[model samples]
Target: MSIKTQKIFEAEFLLEDMREIIRKTSPHSAFSKDDKIQFNEKLKKLSEIVEELRTNKYTELKIKYITNGIELRTREEDFINIHPIQAAGRLTLEARKALISYGDGYSTCDWCRKPFRLDKIHRPPIDEFHSELAEFVGMDQARVVPGARRGFQAVVSSLIEKGDSVLLSAISHYTEFLAVEDSGGTVKEIPLNEKNIVTADATVQKIEDVKKNTKKLPKLIMLDHFDYMFGNEHDVYGIAKVANEYDIPFLYNGAYTVGIMPVDGKKIGADFVVGSGHKSMASVAPSGVLATTDEWASKVFRTTQMVGDITGRKFGIKEVEMLGCTLMGGTLISMMASFPKVVERTKHWDDEVKKSNQFLDEFLAVEGSKVISEYPRKHTLTKVNTTESFDKIAKTHKRRGFFLSDELRKRGIVGEFAGSTRTWKLNTYGRTWDQIKYLGHAFIDIAEKYDVPVKANKQGQYSGDV
Candidate 1:
């Protein structure tokens, strides 16, 4: 039975931390022997598409309705509740009245401009459907999390108290310092700058060096509208104008900048924010999203239903808040019906993430290397080198980014690599521009045959040059 549940989820399993870092970085024995015979013919075409979806040979081919979000859900349904949080707040008010009647009707009914079926849309009006997702992120309310880290531990247990004082950013996002030390609160951190950018004048000089050597004014702050280990992008309205000149609170994390930047989290004076809906709205995976103000959403919904009524819902809280409310009801009805064509397919992967950061900053400014910041964020930045060449550019861009995430999972294409940097994540959602110029010419021919500085003829300094 599935090899006895893969040997009981691979024995002594702590979810095989990235398969034990791909088995102690033997990383499938660093490819080459003709890239290990094209990665064993791409693992036998992903085991012939998982043995043709286990012999049904594609039971009417529903690769989650041809991938890229909203295939309604199904791993054998049943989170029965005429209650998946009240049928996901009545399917987020029937997908906000089919996104305001598919943006004010005017349809010559080709199935009313196709795409509606989450069982034919309807229930909208839960007080104006999560107030149009809390006024589309300038929040005055929002708290939906099928997981934005329990909407960041429901705004750190409704704005800290049991020994408060939380600031952030000494290389942050370690799950917002484990949700402010599992909510008894304390954190502190601050430091960053030699291009690992975290400024608003270094978070107002660490809130003026913690109010001139600490007695606590840091009631809570947090950061990350980019800067997941070097794809830096911050300013967050100049650190919410220095947390409104020290009235404190802040909290941004916009989980990789909510759908890749242009967050308003109330014109950036964030009292709270956090997003992900599976990293910018395709949802699935423990979704995530949070927001604030309606007096911090009735004080984080009474500290998130008093930690969901004394955590009866499980061991260590978050029992799939109904699979994060059915992947936040198919990630907010596939992000309000294809968020303006997912921002017009993110301008064809913003010229392949500015030509893979000017082909890794002209291949590390011709081995003189440096460029962490002179401006780098069209979507995730940071190009390494500070002697150890950060462990040989994180073991040669993690074996060419896990052999381009196993050749984009043999053409079904999915990407991820930003954790052990030589950093690789340039998702140009539902790609093109020759699959981002053949995954940026196979990551600049494996960072120029492992000499790894990376560049060859300035991929003409990005501007419509894919």
Candidate 2:
């Protein structure tokens, strides 16, 4: 489509997408009769433009981008985006609708009330959503934060003081270390086990070593439920038990687990459970949930008591850690709009894991290819080594490392880390079974083309071959 056609196309597509939604929306929802009239009028105008573009032949038209050029990102629409962090975060149709309505900074604050808190606004039932979020993760309280990193900052700032020590997995996200540093604390890493996964026993030993050297119990223990690099599930339950045994506060980093799967903070004996809304909750970027038990919520969400020196003014109800309120815009609204579907999808996590293994079983059939992460994968994000297979071709191909990317792109696949054929990561989180098989076949077909011999699946898990 020409720029002229595409602009009108997108506009019409959006209003039509929201037409059914506005009809089905609750009576108290924000849409009004005037809003409906505006929608219809806009759609009619766009339809006329579309008819004009069609009559004139859209491709022959030259449309100018009057300002900074911006256009639709057709990656998800045009190709299989297997990027690790993105698969689970792709927005729902409902979220897209919400974004159309609440894209501005002040749009979400229209209903701000007496408490003047992000979680207290009820016009769109934001207050109810906050309560639901707490129960979703088996926590007593929850708050929306910018991202999982901010959630970590809140917990670290609350419990960790200057010179305090915290223990975390060796493979934990860098934000964890940054959070600890922000609070003037030191971080101690718990070593990975033989299989490259964090274990409860290792956590205990790390705590013991921290105590031996620092001469005190660590102030906090935080670990990832599933690490980003390997996407392998760590022993969070056992690690949380270890924290309990030592009477230390535990923070479960669910950047990879929450939203995609069911998680119980209390069941894991965790004091805090943090999740990335954009990374896993199908929301916009810079959105996340920070949840905690009542026992720890008071301190973590403590209000500011500092009085303004000049006028003796104080904001007693404003939470100090969250900087009073967070995510007061489309970011929060989109997350709420996607909440219902996110909840339903968590129940199908087993099927998701099954699909991951199904794809990997066939993918590994290409001789010399290797699964770098844990075998029979437990998560969609995977680290793979094709050094012995595709890298061999990269050595002599004209495009070198880019040849593999070129071939994958030809097959309608994208989002593999570009220019790296030796070892790289990909995600299959939300891909359909047919798409997964297509991916597997794409790999095998590419292998055959490059003389990278494809063999039968020894496990018979995926019998189809390219």
Candidate 3:
């Protein structure tokens, strides 16, 4: 059977069984001892669903619901629901197992033993994994954090003081702003060019401007490899060079690049590197890695050496900023399980970009569709303006923006933001060639049905004339 067919079949088959299980597991349900035993037996019979969950057989599941007197079923694909294409870094099979096995409290602690350090030398596996993580990002030391934002918090808290200036891209993620603000530091945004790319020259100018205005150099420079809004790749290498010349510490925000693309912290001249496990490292939510060079590791990961003056007690084991250990449960294990696959996939990043651009070309084949992001797309996630074609229908149709979403849904496509017709974003990450082709065709078919003017390119790919 085809991929879509298989998924639909699986979803239909599991629906009733899962519903029954959920009913039995509901907290409101009152079960006698015998009833509990019966439910346990029933759960054992649902070995398939359990196995699927354990193995990460599918990244998403479709559910049927009766709404407004109409029966409807829809697929819930991650990341794509809000954007066009999914990013390459979703959870892996091993990650799913790790989540289940280590999700219980103290599981990680049990394995690592005394001190409970994620990178302690006594625990060879955890220590080795820590070493591997550092090596993966070309840094001297690494630590798993609650998320990328925590990594930012750690670095900012370590470096920034009240009234200090920090340089950031105008399009930087909100978490960066929060991190800086929490550190009592002032932010200076590096303006983007017409292309929305943060150029090295612009960063240098901003640094000089900040120094002139504040009478002091900014304490840190943080920039994203690919901004979330546009998924546009910036000149990080160039920016890093500028930071080096100014003797400013640079933090490379690799939340979108670390697991999906190759990055070298040293090569980029980054004093610190931060990455998101859920967004790009094939792990569950709220997990990330913070890596730094040897020069800064002592400061960023400094151990707690404070003593309780009255009690005469000392706590010297935990890192000050980390607050003991971060990513203690399934999150860390899932990241560990996904590390090898993440490493392997980064090698084929070029092919992934090629596929992204190919799909974009076909998508733009529809008349009046224009890509809002940079051309010759370097990233899979793209912002698009569909004002000319889809928006025309949205203007007249009673359903408005929802007409396009309904059409795509019927064609087994999901992920486009609901009620959005003029401008929207989508990610085409981790999709197979066949799926990509079908997606392009789905859009073209919808436009043709609505009488939208669509002309095929010379290559005849997605020529709405079909």
All candidates: TM-score: 0.30, 0.89, 0.85
Estimate, for each residue in 194-222, the C-alpha lDDT of model 2 and write its tens digit: 88999999988998999999999999999
lDDT of 1 by residue, 296-412 (tens): 555555422324466566323222222222232444443554444433433454554675454444435434345454455455344344233333555555463355344333433
Question: lDDT rank, highest first?
Answer: 2, 3, 1
What C-alpha RMSD separates each model from the true structure?
21.2, 5.2, 6.1
Candidate 1 residue runs with Cα over 4 Å from true position: 1-101, 105-191, 197-208, 211-214, 225-230, 233-252, 255-273, 276-279, 282-297, 300-370, 373-433, 438-466
- Quantify all predictions' global Cα lDDT against the true fold: 0.53, 0.89, 0.83
Candidate 3 lDDT by residue in tens digits, 1-466: 2334345445444454545655676786676677666666656645655566567675355434444655343344421232442354467878876775677775677756666676773432777888899999999999999889999999999999999999999999999999999999999999999999999999989998998999999999999999988989999999999999999999999998999889999999999999999888988778889999999999999998888889978775789999887876777788899999999999988887888888877788888999999989998888999998899999999999999988887776667888999999888777777667677777888988989877776775453322
Model 1, C-alpha of 281: deviation from truth (Å):
3.3
By TM-score, the better pick of 1 and 3 is: 3
Model 1 C-alpha RMSD to native: 21.2
**Is 1 or 3 the stronger prediction by lDDT?**
3
Better of 2 and 3 by lDDT: 2
TM-score-better candidate, 1 vs 2: 2
